[model samples]
Target: MTTVTAPPPPAARTATPAPLVSVRGLQVAYGDGPLVLDGVDLDLFPGETVALLGSSGSGKSTLMKSLTGFAPITGGSAQVAGHDVGTLRRGRLRNLRADVGQVFQQFNLVGRLSVLTNVLTGALHGAGPVNAVGGFSSADRQRAMALLDRVGIAHKAKDQARTLSGGQQQRVAIARALMQRPRLILADEPVASLDPTMSHQVLDLLQEIARADGIPVLVSLHVLHLALDHSDRVVGLRHGEVLVSSPTAELDAERLAVVYDVSDADQEADDAGH
Candidate 1:
C-alpha cells in the first residue's frame, strides 16, 4: 500500500489578494474634455468601509464610475472583483455588473413597485432573459426578503417603494444591493438626501454590512463628520488628485478641510480681485 497524504491541505490557500478592488493611476475624461480624474489610486479591502471625501468636482463620482466602467478611462487601470475594467468585453461587462452592487444617491427604486419587487430586480443581473418575464422565482423572493430583514425593513416588503420615508427607502435600496450577493459595493453619496440622524443611521448600517459580510464597501460622502464616524479608512480627493489617504483614526476634520477649504478660498480670492 502506498502511503497517501492529503496533499498538506492545499497549503491553506495562503496567498489571497489584499483587496477586492484595486485601482492604480486611474484617469477618466469625458470625450475631448480635460481629465476629470488624474492618477487616482485606491484599494478597497474586505471587511472595510472606505469613505471617499472631497468637495464638489474633485472627481469622487468619476472615480466610482470608473470602477464600474461607466466613465471613460483615458489611462491607467482598475481591477474590481478580479475583472479588469479597461479590458473587459461586452459579455464580461454583464458579469462585472452582476458582481458589483451599487447604491445611488436617489435610492433608484421603482416607486410603484412593491419594495420586495424592487429588491428582486437586483437578482436580474444574475438571471437570464427567459427567467425575467416569468417573474422572480420562489428562491429569489425568499432571498430578497432575507435581504430586507438584514436591512431592518422586512415588514415593509409588501408596501409600495414610494410610500416609505427617505431613510426607509434607503434601507430598501441597501437591501436591493445585498440581494445581488455582490463581491463589492459602491455607494455614491448614499446619505446626501437624508437628515443628520438618518445619515448616521445609514452610514452605520453600511459599515455593519461591510464587516459582517467581509465585503469591501466604498462610500462617497460630502460630510466630513460622517466619514470620520463610520469609515475604517478615508481617502480624500482634491482637484481630481488624491490629497490624503490614511486610516480614519489617524485623521480629523482640520486636515480634511484642505480638500474642501481651498476651493472656497480660491473663489473668494477671485471675487476680491474682481
Candidate 2:
C-alpha cells in the first residue's frame, strides 16, 4: 500500500473588512507618454477619512481620475464598489461614474443657480436629465434642504451660489456632493480656496459624515498640517508611487519629508485613485 498523508489544515487568516475602493499595482500613462502613476496600491475602507499627500506632478490628480474612468489604466486592476474599472463597458462606466461623488478645489457649482437648485443637480447622477432644474420634485427639494442643513448652509439655500463666501460656497459644493447619496466621496483639494477656519470646519464635517454614514472619504490636500489634523490616515506619494501609508497618529512632518524630496513635511498633498 502506498503511503498517504492528509494535508494539514490551512492556516487561520486574519479577517480584513472589504474595501470600498481597491487598487493593485496600478499604472497610468497617456498615449505613449511616461507613466504618470506607477505601481500604486491603495484601499479606501468604510468610515474612514484618508488624505492623499504629494507635491504637484506627483500624480495626485491622475490617481483620482482613474477611479471615475477618466484616467486610462495601462496596467494593474482597480475594483471599486465591485466594478472592475479597467475592463468596464461604456454603459457600465457611466453607472460607475454615477456612484462616486466628486468635490473640487474651485467649488464647481453653477454661479447663476440658487444653492438649493445646485444641490439638486447631484440627484441627477443616477437619474436621467429632467426638463429643468425648476422641475425637480418636492421630495428632492426636501432632501436638498436636509443636505444643506447637514452641511450647515440651509439658510443660504435660496441665494445664488456665487453670492456666498468662498467657505460657504465650498460648503454648498460639499452639500451638492452629499445630495448624490454617494457610495464613495473624492474631495480634490476641496478646502484649497477657503480660509484656515473654514478649512478646519469643512474637514471636520467630512470626518463626521464618514463616521455617521459609514462611507469612505478620500481627500487630496496641499497643506501638510491640514492633512495631519484632518485625516484619520495618510497616503504619501513620491514620483508616482506610494512612499508611505500609515495611520495619522504614526506619521509626522519629518516622517513624511521623503514624499516631497524635502527636509520636512510642511509641503503638499491621500486614500488615492487615478
Candidate 3:
C-alpha cells in the first residue's frame, strides 16, 4: 500500500478595517455628456502612495475630482475620510472637503501672500470665525510653520509666494495641504509643471509624508517613470475605464502599456479604415 501525507494548515488571516478611501463602480458624466468615468474601483490605505496614471482624457483627473466632490458622479459609491461622498449633505460637504487635503499642478497659492499666510489658509476650510486677517491662534501658526519646515521651505515663510521657484512653490503647496491635518490627500498632477529634479523631489516628499503621517495619498501623474519610481501601487485608466490596478512591485513599464493602448488602437483603426 502507498503512504499518504496530510497537508499543512493554512495561515490565519488578519482583520483590518476599511481603507482611508474606498470607491466602487464609480460613474460620472457632465451635462448629459458621455460617461467620463465608468465602473471604476479604487482603495487607498494608510501609509501608502497610490499613483494614478493615464493618457490625456483617460479620466485620471476626473477620478481625483470625484473624491473631493468636484466631479459630477452619476453612479456608484465613494467614501473618503469616513464620509460618503455620493451622499454628502450641503453642510456635510464642507466637512468632507476639510478632511481632504489637495495639491495641484499650478501650486495654487496666492502669489501676493506670504508663504506662511498661504499655508494658514488651509485651516480656513470649515473654520468658524477664526479671523483670517489678524487672529489665527498661536498653535495654528506654530503648526503651519512646522509643516512648512517639514516641506523644506520654512526659511521662506516670510517671502511672497510668487517669488519662490516652481519647486519651492510646490513645496509650499504641500505644506499648506499638511496644515489641513487631512486623513486623505488627492494630488492632481502635483508635479506636472516642475522640471525632472523638482518632480522627483516633490514626489519623494509626498511619499515620505504618506508613510510618516499614516495618511493615504492618491496622486495623479502623467509621467510613467515617476509613477513607477514613487508609488506603492498604481491604477491605470484607459478611456474612462480601469485597465490595470496592482502593487508596484508586481508591475513594470511593459505592464502599464494598457493605459495608452486603447487610444493608440483607435488611432490605428482610423488609419486602417482610411
Candidate 4:
C-alpha cells in the first residue's frame, strides 16, 4: 500500500471563505407591528446562489431588506459586506447599499431612458453631486455597453428601455445590476413577472453571474422548481422563522413543502371559521 492518504486531502481545502453576508438571531418589525422576521440566521458566501423560499408574508422580503438596512431590526444583528447593517450610519448605509445590487419583480428602469443610460445609472450609486451634474463619464459609457453586451442585448442598448420585451428588459435590469460592481446581489421575486421560459433564462444568468464574479446572490422566489433548479443552497422561511435550510442537492418539492405547511392552529381556525 502506498499509504499516501491522498496528500492529506489537500489541507482540507483551506476551509470555506468567510461569508460576505451573515445574519445571526435576526429579528425585524415594522413600527410596533408584529414581527416580520424572528430569530432568522443566514449566511451567504462568495460565488454561491442561495434561494430564499417562502409563501406570501413569510418574511422573505423582510430578510432581504434587513441585509440592506431597509427593514427595522427590532433585535439581533445582520452584517453585510462587513458592515453591521443594524447599526450602520447614514453614510455607511449608503456605502452598503452601493455594494449591493438589487433586482425587483417589476423591472425598475426609467422607461424614457435608453437601455445604455439605464444601465449606466447603476454607477451613480454612492456617487457625489458633481458626477450627477456632469453626467456619466466616457469610461462609464464604455463599461455600460460592455455589460449590455454581456447580457446579450448590445444591439438594443440604444433603444428606449421600455421598448424591450419582458425578458429583454429583465436582461437589461440584470446588466444594470452588474454595472454596480456589487459585492452581493439581492433579487426580490426577480422572476415573478416573467413567463416560465424567461424565468429560467433570467435565473440562469443570475447564477452564472454569481459564479463568474465570485459574488453572493440572494434571490427570493415563490416557485419551487425554479429554486430547486438554480440554487446551490436553499433557505426556507415560515411565519418569520427559518423552517428549512439545506443544500439544494438534498432538497425536493416534498422536502421543501414544509416551509409552506399551514400550522395546526391556523388550520383549526380556518376550519372553525368555515
Cα miss at 92, model 4 (Å)? 1.3
Tens-digit lDDT track of model 4 for 2-40: 775555444545688999998999989899789989999
Query: What CA RMSD would candidate 1 show?
Result: 6.9
Tell me the TM-score of each prediction against the true structure. 0.89, 0.89, 0.89, 0.91
Residue pairs of candidate 3 with colliding backbone atoms: none
Candidate 4 residue pairs that clash: none
Instruction: Give the lDDT of residue 134 in candidate 1.
Output: 53
Q: What is the lDDT of residue 242 in candidate 3?
A: 94
Each model's C-alpha lDDT?
0.89, 0.87, 0.88, 0.89
Highest-scoring model, TM-score: 4
TM-score preference between candidates 3 and 4, better one = 4
Pairs in clash, predicted candidate 1: none
> What would the per-residue lDDT of candidate 1 be over residues 183-262, giving only the tens digit for each residue?
99999999989987898899999999999999899999877778888999999998799999999999877667777766
Of 1 and 4, the candidate ranking higher by lDDT? 4
